[model samples]
Target: MKKRLIVGISGASGAPIAVELLKALRDTGIESHLIISHGGACTIRQETSLSVEEVQALADKVYAQVDIGAGPASGTWESLGMAIVPCSMKTVAGIWSGYSDNLMLRAADVTLKERKKLVLVARETPMSPIHLRNLQELSMMGAVIMPPVISYYHHPQSPEDITRHLVGKILDQFQIDLPQFCRWEGEPHV
Candidate 1:
């Protein structure tokens, strides 16, 4: 089977990051199986010029959020792992509570049960105790809790640059080196 990865997009502010990640995955020739929540569809409309269909076009395959019987919902579907880019707090809670109400959540649950890497690009600030607790528990359960934190050392000049940097960092978790990602080589020599 070809190298595949499941990408989930939930409602969050960083919809562009998800878009960039999908583009990067396409550029890398990795087959992306995508599942976007209702909120994700809305966010893509509000935050990006491209429609949700355009974004879905970037992936090798797309699954409807309501389709719980999709290929990704099964552990038998081989994949490198799954990344829920711009994961909303609600989605985090759903996954933490083991509530597989939709394909995105079900795929995440399967990723965990299969002992595959599940990266949640948690998008929230000033995380409340409830959110933190959920994240902590999810981490304990072997899911990576990645936030869309910006790095200054890279000297990002625009929002796209920042988004690319963040996407690169997320890709790093899957051991895929994004060519544009500026890695820290240590403190700049004086």
Candidate 2:
């Protein structure tokens, strides 16, 4: 099978990041297997002009989030890893506890079991103590808990630019490069 990356879209504020990530994956010729949770579908409608179907089109394959038997739910499916963009706290808790109630969570669980990369763009502000603890445990378990925190050093001019930069950073965890991703250079000599 071609190189594959599982992309999970959960309900969170940064839906645009997920959209851009899909577009980037398409541009790089990576086969993207997408799974959008019910909350994710709602977030797409609320946050972006594109419908969930439109976003799904960017991926090479789309799986229903409710389908727990989906290809990504099994370790045998084989993939570079899984990325949950705009991951909600609920989804994080689900994965941290191995509560594979849906395909997205199940895929994450499988990724951890297979010792594959599981990058979570956790999108929440002022994370509660519970959130921090869960995230800490997940990090200890080897999942990359990358919240969508902005980097001013990149000098992002617009929201899209920020989103792309964040997506690039997430892809970096998988060793995938986004051509437009700007790397930070140290201060210029006086």
Candidate 3:
């Protein structure tokens, strides 16, 4: 069977990461099922030249946020794992509290209940005590909370480079490899 991955795009600042991740998955022959929150769509419009439909077109399948009956909302759906790139604080809180108000949250909840890999790329600045606590709760609940911080050791030359490194790392969690990923050999060298 083809490897299936569910990708969620939350309303966070780093819309570029989602686009890169989608492009990488598409190139690698991974059938991606994408879910985009309303805020996610708004952010895409704000940050990217690609329209919402254009972004949706990146995935093999796309589901509405309110579609509770979608395939990803169930545990029986055969998927490798799920990810919420640029996961917003609201989205984070929803998953941390098991709030299945939308398909993204429901899919994440299902992923957690089924013990599948659920990667959350939380993007926020100067995390408050509440953010830290919520993130801690998510970590304790078996979710990998990635903040998308830059790894300066890679000697990134452009915005695209940083985005690729982070996207590659996210895909790495699902055992998905992309050659564009800057793999850290050991120590930084000139």
Candidate 4:
């Protein structure tokens, strides 16, 4: 059977990461179940030409952010793992505190409790003490708190290239490595 992954898009600055990840997931034939927050929806609108409905259309299934009773909100629902691409601090705090205020957080909470892979692509740059502490708390609890740090060695020529790298790293947390990303050898690719 095809692998299923839960994708949560928070209202973080890096909307491209989610877009590329979804595209990659589709290319790989990995079933994606998506949940997006209000902020995430706004970010998608602000950052991309794709409408919120268009983004949602990329996924095999989409869950309303407010639906805490969604299938993904329960641990019994099987999945390879879940990733919050461009994870916002609000989402981070919610997951860190086990504060399932919405479907995204609730699903992430369930992912952690079920010992499934839970990757958070935290997007804030100037992280405050609260952010750091929350990240630490989440990391300690076994979530992969990955920041969208770009690797310059690849010498990416375009935004899409960088997005591919970020998407690759995000998917890597779930052991889903796509060949579209550049892998650093002993030296940088020129």
Candidate 5:
């Protein structure tokens, strides 16, 4: 059976990361259920040429932000796991605090409560102690706090290259095989 992935996009600045992740999932022929928060939609408009509809079209399935009744909101939904690419601090706090006011948070909460992998691509800088504490709490709860930090070892030369590099790393957490952006031999490049 095809693995099901629930992809959440929040109001974080790195909307391209979310888009690239979705595209990579599509390339791999995985079924992606997407949920974009209101702020996420605005960021997409600011960051990419693709319209909101175009971005939503990339997903195999789409759920509204307020639709807490969606299938992914329950552990019985039988999905591989959920990822919140470009996860905002607000959404992170919601997930950490068990605030299921929206579909994104609800899905993430379900993933954690069900002991399923919930990868959070936290996209914030100059984080306060509060943010750090929340991340720590989530980590303790079995959520993968994957920040969108790029590796310079890849020698990425463009924005797209950086985005792909990070997305590849995210897929790694899911154990979803994809071509490596840059291979590491644990030694200096020949």
Candidate 6:
């Protein structure tokens, strides 16, 4: 069966990561259920040529950020996992505090409560103690607190290359194998 993944895009600056993740999922024949926050919508327009509609069109299913009634908000809904690419610090805090004000937070909360994989591509830098504590809490709760740290081992040559590498790492946490990028080996390439 095709795996169902919940893709949440928050208002983080790295919108390209979310875009590439969605495209990778589509390319890999996985079903994506997406939720784009208002800030995410703005960042996409600011960062990419693709329109918000074009991005939403890539998903098998799309939910509004405020749609707490969405299937992803229910633990009973069978999904492989959820990934929040370019996860905002605000969203991370919300998840840490069990604040399900929006669908993204609610879905993440559900993913945690259901003991499913929750991958967060956190995007903040020079984080405060609060941020670190929130990440710690989420980590304790089984959420993968991944950041957008790219590896140079693959010899990335472009923005797309970098994005693919990071997305591949995110998918790795979910055990979704895709040929998005090459794994690192500590040997010099000839």
**TM-scores, each model vs. reference:** 0.97, 0.97, 0.96, 0.95, 0.96, 0.95
lDDT (Cα) of model 3: 0.92
- What TM-score would candidate 4 get against the native? 0.95
Clashing pairs in 1: none
Regions of candidate 5 where Cα sits further than 4 Å from its true position: 188-190
Model 1 segments more than 4 A misplaced: none
Worst 10 residues of 4 by lDDT: 180-189
| Model 6: lowest-lDDT 10 consecutive positions | 177-186
Task: State each model's CA lDDT, in order.
Answer: 0.93, 0.93, 0.92, 0.90, 0.91, 0.90
lDDT of 4 by residue, 106-142 (tens): 9999999998889999989799999999999889999
Residue 138, candidate 1: how far off, in angstroms? Answer: 0.5
Q: Could you give candidate 1's per-residue lDDT for residues 46-133 as a string of tens digits?
A: 9999999999999999999889998899989999999999899999999999999999999999999999999999988889999999
Clashing pairs in 6: none
Better of 3 and 6 by TM-score: 3
Query: lDDT winner among the candidates?
Result: 1
Residue 14 error for model 1, in Å? 0.7
Tell how far residue 117 is off in model 6, in angstroms: 0.3
Report the lDDT of model 4 for residue 9: 93
Residue 57 lDDT in model 3? 96
State the lDDT at 103 in candidate 5. 92
lDDT of each residue in 1-190, candidate 3, tens digit only: 3499999999999998999999999999999999999899999999999999999999999999989999999999999889999899999889888889999999999999999999999989988888899999889989998999998888899998899999989999999889857787886577
> Which of the two, 4 or 5, has more TM-score?
5
Total backbone collisions for each predicted model: 0, 0, 0, 0, 0, 0
- List where candidate 4 sits over 4 angstroms from the true fold: 188-190
